[model samples]
Target: GFAGNTIPIVAGSALLALRALEEDTKANGKITITRGDNPWVDKIYTLMDKVDEFIPTPERDTDKSFLMAIEDVFSITGRGTVATGRVERGSVKVGETIELVGLGNTRTTTVTGLEMFQKTLDESVAGDNVGVLLRGVQKTDIERGMVIAKPGTITPHTKFESQVYVLKKEEGGRHTPFFCGYQPQFYVRTT
Candidate 1:
């Protein structure tokens, strides 16, 4: 437990840290980043209002069937390979059958174990980040961006139609139109 050091720094310190992280990230990879000024700097109340307007409280659908996006995979000695990721929907428990779907393959596997933060769990629900030990799959076969989901729940595709929103120039965004094959970067847990 991180006790005193575990807590997060906020406001100015957090903003400064974001800038520092941008530089560190660029050095680690052949990527470019830009850290812009916070229009709400020193304006906590206004920022809070904007946050409330834009983002709402998260609602986890534990009642749905199991779903987890595979963020990583690794093998344990004698225990089989593990697919690790957050439960985007529903819940999963030990000994249940699951399907690994996405990235050009689909396979059925049993959940031999479930773990989080070095602790073994009987079940993990929506919003719970977990690592699932699986039987009959190789760590080399499963890749990131795949889903460990309930059987017949997910449909994988190489392309699909989607709606997009482009920000205006005033909000530090360009009003640029996208052309064919204009791929954009996405972060972790993108559905």
Candidate 2:
């Protein structure tokens, strides 16, 4: 009972804060709040409606090319190498060709199969979490943080720029600066 009321309120507040940050940054996306039936549901619903009023729908890329962010890579005895992740854009069909782009290299491969929840699928579209069986690639050649996309649609970047937001400063003392070549373990899309 304690959590039922407090959790929704806290989560709703956090979402509202994030929405405000998005507005400050002029970001393009809507935040929709979904929750179970609870005492605070009405407040969350009101907040959701208020946020949705100002947030605009994200623009969809017109390109028909497909892309998936690789989350796991493994090999099956009869299936060769399989890469699993959500299809981030477009659609990929069972027999289509795609390229694995990452780690300063790219490998073109054919989609031998696609499966979700152990059932085979003829095609997988955006937002679908599917395991793709690839031909002519070994398990060692693929890894997490790689992007699977239609050939020629994506190119590996040698260097890129990004903005970092430090959520919390160290409690004890001043924060140390990270110099060039400081490698941190990177996690992307649950990988």
Candidate 3:
């Protein structure tokens, strides 16, 4: 029962922390993050009517934007096609098929399921959640986050243009009002 005691304690702590975080997020709309930023969490900012965007500076300045490599692909029996991880721009919708482009190759698949934030939806657009599924293609062909899109819609590019912005901070270690024309890292999604 040693593991049980410790596990429940940890679980309870996590639940409480999550509750507090949800409350804080509701009241403030956004949390000032310091490390390990999940672009999805910030996606809410874009989804919500609150503000425009959150920009992060890249480690180095270069014309080529980073591409998420495909990790793995899955083919569920009778469930259709689905891809996991490496989410780029836009959203993946259930029953809506998209093209998988990368590695000097491209293919098409229909979305069967879109899972994000412990919630499953019929479709997922940009900033929806995470785990996306499609209809066509096989497990051997696709990989994780392989930049799914509509055929002929997008092409693999080493370089792209993006607009970056950051929240204005006040003098007392607080966020100031938002403004336009601010320069910051541009967090972009490719699909």
Candidate 4:
């Protein structure tokens, strides 16, 4: 369930979650559901083969290709810059070189370290939220809405086409009509 104002966004996220669970179950032959006090806990538990017992391992591709959606950026005392985000595809490891793509430019940088929940990790795979310290890049060079990816794997683009639903018009009386060339601040991932 979602709040009143976030129904559409939550629905899309729920759909994706269900799809991922289905894929995991099919690949692993079993699924585990953690019990909680939430109303839907029992419903989810009933759909699984085990409760708090089965651990599904996700396959990680470490073929030198990866992508991360930047959620936050900060600077450390000794480290140059750090970007935190979930790995969207492939895997990244310490010492690997990557390209930062955003803000109408691309900069190449190396991964100096990786951390999650205040603990350092040698690598991070898809679906793992982690912070990566980067070398040769300043904090001002990165920002939210940027993407970090393996060098030569992605090309940054300024124009994109997407379908948007106008909620105001669907609620009740007519609002200001939107026309072509209308621009709005778009939020993606955690940005």
Candidate 5:
């Protein structure tokens, strides 16, 4: 079940990333950002550039988005979970089944298993990244920035609201201020 544990942690962390994307939507409505220091992870940061500065938290707060990182997954004999997540804001614990969605879509699955640092647990709360095990999902179905929630809480977003900032260099940042008449390419989490 190593795959099962690793998949959820990876998928769960990806979902958290989407929440950050939503936050960027609120600030500038549209924005353009360069990749981060990490090439693979930073690539996703570039995608947020089309959105605005303001980002929406999972709580729908207008505050800045929190960061979630996938550290690594380890296997323990007789244990049924993998370690994942680098908490940037809140703490994550065990025994909680969170919503697990995919990038580019909103449909989601549930995280049926979880664990903390090393102790076996049923769920993981917030803060601090944790390892986890999943039930009823496959490996290939997940990607970076997938959306995860606390059951029945993950909502589908076909067309939602956001803040977008135009790339300063793209249009010389000389467009009329407060103007809202453009539709740039959009990228978000999907089932």
Candidate 6:
């Protein structure tokens, strides 16, 4: 739940950091960074009696097929394009054909490399934050919410409807029902 709130906010903010792997030979990688710079965070936590709780790692949703949410995308000057995010499920290896699906953009490319914490990896599974180098797609080809997965594993949709409950002011939620043309935020994995 912490990651659910943190990743999307940082993704939209200007604080997303893009780094090159030198010791880890990073072609590209994106990491979620939450700075406790908020003046209210301490008070909020102290009021809840959980002052020691920092950023909580999301529980890894281990599965059988490869899935990774695109947290960041950038290009290395001489090598190739890199996508970085935590693997949500399954595993992917170098040279495996993967599909980028989201935001009405679907493209196929081969995974040329994966690097995490500056070290190269042969494969990345759920819970590992890694940067994946691609063979064909350019940095401009993908977006933050697009997912990298085994080809045919996902289908992209342009629109979908979800049910949301409007809470009362007594419950610390909005007191009024949404008016016409109200748009709510949707947080799906990293995107």
Q: State the lDDT of candidate 1 residue by residue for 57-120, as single tens digits.
A: 7999999989999988898988889988889899988999999998777889899899999999
lDDT by residue for model 2 (1-191), tens = 45554332224465555555456456445533345433255456666775677557665442568989999998999769999998877999998988989885788889999999999999888878899999989989988899999999878876667776654456554377678998755555464
Which has the better lDDT: candidate 1, or candidate 6?
A: 1
lDDT of 6: 0.76
TM-score of each: 0.60, 0.61, 0.41, 0.64, 0.37, 0.64
In order, candidate lDDTs are 0.79, 0.77, 0.53, 0.79, 0.46, 0.76
- Minimal lDDT window, size 10, model 3: 60-69
Error of 3 at 63 (Å): 22
> Tens digit of lDDT per residue, candidate 5, span 29-112?
964333552343454554454233334444422132332333444444554434366434433334444555434554334444
Candidate 2 clash pair list: none
* 104-161: candidate 3 lDDT, tens digit per residue: 5777666667777768877544333366666656677765445766556678765667
| Cα distance off (Å), candidate 5, residue 42 | 40
Q: Which RMSD values do the candidates have, in order?
A: 14.4, 13.4, 18.8, 12.1, 21.6, 13.8
| lDDT ranking, best first | 1, 4, 2, 6, 3, 5
Expressed as tens digits, the lDDT of each residue in 90-165 for candidate 4 is 8988999999997868988899999999999998988888999999888888999999999999888788998887
Model 6 misplacement above 4 A: 1-63, 175-177
